[model samples]
Target chain A: MNLSLTLTINGEQREIVLDDPRVTLLDLLRERLHLTGAKKGCDRGQCGACTILVDGQRINSCLALAISYDGSAITTIEGLAENGALHPVQQAFIDHDGFQCGFCTPGQIMSAVGLIAEAQADGDAERIREAMSGNICRCGAYQGITEAVLDAQAKISTGKERDAA
Target chain B: MNRFEYVRPTSIAEAVAAAGEPGSAYLGAGTNLLDLMKGGVTQPSRLVDLTHLPDLGQIEQLPDGSTRIGALVKNAALAHDPAFAEAFPAVAEALLSGASAQLRNAATVGGNLMQRTRCAYFTDPASACNKRAPGSGCDAIGGENRAHAVLGWSDHCIAVHPSDFCVALTALGAIVEIEGPAGRREVAMTDFYLLPGDTPEKETVLDAGEMIVAVRLPAEAAAFAGNQRYLKGRERTSYAFALASAAAALKIENGLIVEARLALGGVATKPWRVQAAEAVLAGAAPGKEAFEKAAEVAFAEAKPSGDNAYKIALGKRVLARALMMAAAGTPERMPALPASPFAPLPEGVVNV
Candidate 1:
């Protein structure tokens, strides 16, 4: 059965027509919308390759039905950079060599963004590692990933402090 | 995943009616449901989406001092809720310790309670599982069953319920509010999950068409907030299911245990509450002697179903350490590893 869904993807309103109810948000983004930036690594939600922000919270898009997320705002890895400048998290991932195969980097970066927004870690390396435990790096880049998240969180907090001052 | 008819109902009545059908399933965040579907474990003909329903997402403080948590409240939201955490620290810690950050962000309180066993045999369609298919032989009995149930297991099934939150809820005496075609009703958290008897397929007390609306924590359940701990023993420090877990809560007065609440998880078909153990702790001082005695009573009826005899011993240690940690008092802040054994504990206390 065909279903209609309206998603504010990457800060842009895109009314999508779903030909099937079985289409996951990850499938809808990669297959139909051609937004393959959100990789589909273990489509069963075991790996966080398809992680994305839904209403400012990180979730496994592979397990989410596109029809269920209608009228919700979503953010993907593609939206991290603005006007030719990479988001701090994206830059930090590169600076810290957060991935070997770059397969789980998009998910790691998106999860990092969502984690930073939650602000529960407070830039603690242990807390960042714990909070980002959802995303797995098969290439064994957890150390770099943890360092990247810590650096990015420190930068974001320092920037906020400067703005407040 | 099979293509199913998706229907979004805005009201509880409508959702209940829609899910009453034989092949209908209620969709929460689909964190677990979709995984099962993708694995070809469960294929419902119709999905009744419950995400859009209003009034099922609020966390309210009732005038009677009880806290009514809506079933739709996301796990992350509930865990991060400062007031809720302060009132039910172990429950918050259990929720944080479960699954992963991404799953918790999307998973709901009700969905967590409804999650199925992580047993490989149950998920693999080729394997004969009595829990998955009634009357089918249980492959887990002779198969690799190191992580199977120890507390409650029949010849038919040995799968354990993989929920850390339910363990803490059972210990704290949480009440589950249900709405169904018949009417609204409440069931104690301890009684909500059914043990695997001859009919392992019947996992819960909920009849067809009944839905969990909210979970209520009695005002008195908050009394143990001063001394509560949920400790989980997992294969990994994070993002792993529990091998054995314990939720321990004590109400101590004048160096004596006024009351105690204890429950075991990842070692049973349900959140196994040991009221007998609690009775042993009453009027006794909180210390190694009493905790060890209670741990023995807690595992008095436990027996391994398969190659999981080690779980019985591991479970005993988990409960004892959890009680010791609870007696030491809850930490001011959530541990960095939440419920993991690696989290920093009281001085002179060893990891289980």
Candidate 2:
């Protein structure tokens, strides 16, 4: 059975047709829409390569079925940059070398962005670190990723910019 | 993943009715169920997405001074709740120490409780895992079982229950308030997850149609909480499966061990409670010797495999040290040494 889902992606309102109940939002974005910034490392939820934001909270899009999320506003790595400008979290990652091969960078940056926003709203470093723990880098670049989160917090605190493939 | 009918039920009755079907499943937080589906492990005929059901998404206080946590309450929210932190701090610590923050944010309490094994063999379709395919046989029994259970494992399975939150909750005397197709009933934390005896397929005793509505934990257990600690031993420092873990909750009255609760994870198929050990130290004065003896009692029934024999000793050492650290609470006490995941499993890889 097919389900029609209307939602926002990168600030644009779009409607998606879920051909199968098993097709996830991440699958819909990468396979159908061809927005492949979110990599599928494990397909399972163990890896955080498919992290995205729905209403400003980080969720593993692989586990979120497309039809279930029927009218909610969604955001992916493709949505982080607007009008040729990058989100502070993405920029901080670039500056801090948060990723190496960068396969997991988009998901990492997305998780960091959500975490930093929560931190700004009175979340402590421990809380931020605890929250961002799901996103893993096989390159063992956690030190850099955490530093970039702090850096992003600093830049977002002031006003600065940084993104690219 | 197999094609299934989907229904985003907005109310509990609708959701329950949808899940009441023969092969219907409740997708709470969709953490484990979806993962299993993609791997072709579980292919339910229908998925009743319960995220939209408002009835199962609340956290409130009961008249008995206990807290009722909705099944849909995200792990992150439950971990950070003021009442959870203050009342069931061990549970809070367990939740925090569980999957990283992002996972906890999206993972619901019910989902976390129902998460499947992280065993590589189980996830790998070709591998022989009895839990995944009953009567297929357990490869971990004689294979690479460094991460497998060291206690309460039968011949059929040795896989461990992966939640750190359940370990502490087991010790805190938490209860599961559930609603099945028939009616609503409550289960204590101890009886929730079953050990892998002859039937590895039977994980929980709950009826198939029964869905967990809320988890109610005694608010008083938080009062007994003092210097709670959750120590995990993993291959890597962060975001890896546990080799062995210890959860300690101790109370110091009159400079002695008035009450204590200890549970082990990653080393057992169930959240193992050492009540005998607790009974040993119930009135005994706090000291290294008493703690060591009590720790030994906890591991008394440890039947280890080839790769985890040292875990018997390692669990005792860490449990003793963690209990000591928890009891002392002052800076004068020295921290326990990190345990090693060094033991190797036996030679033959058994497949039923």
lDDT of 1 by residue, B1-352 (tens): 8878999998999999999999998999999999999989999999999999999999999999999999999999999999999989999999999999999999999999999999999999999999889998999999999999998889899999999999999999999999999999999998898989999999999999999999999999999999999999999999999999999999999999999999999999999999999999999988888888999999999998889999989999999999999999989999889998888788756554
Candidate 2 lDDT, B1-352, residue by residue in tens: 8888888877777777778889898898787788888888888898888888876778888888888889989987886676566666656666766665567778898888888888778887888889888999888877888777778989889888888888877777878988877878899988988888888878887787788888887866766655566666676645566677777787777787778888888888888887899899888877777888998899888887658787887778768766765664522211111121221111221110
Chain A TM-score of each candidate structure, as shown: 0.97, 0.89
Error of 1 at A56 (Å): 0.9
CA lDDT of each candidate? 0.93, 0.76
Model 2 chain B lowest lDDT segment of ten? B343-352
Candidate 1: list runs displaced more than 4 Å: B348-352
Model 1 Cα RMSD, 1 decimal: 0.9
Residue A151, model 2, lDDT: 76
Q: Measured against the native two-chain assembly using Cα atoms, what DockQ does each of the candidate structures obtain, in the order listed?
A: 0.93, 0.48
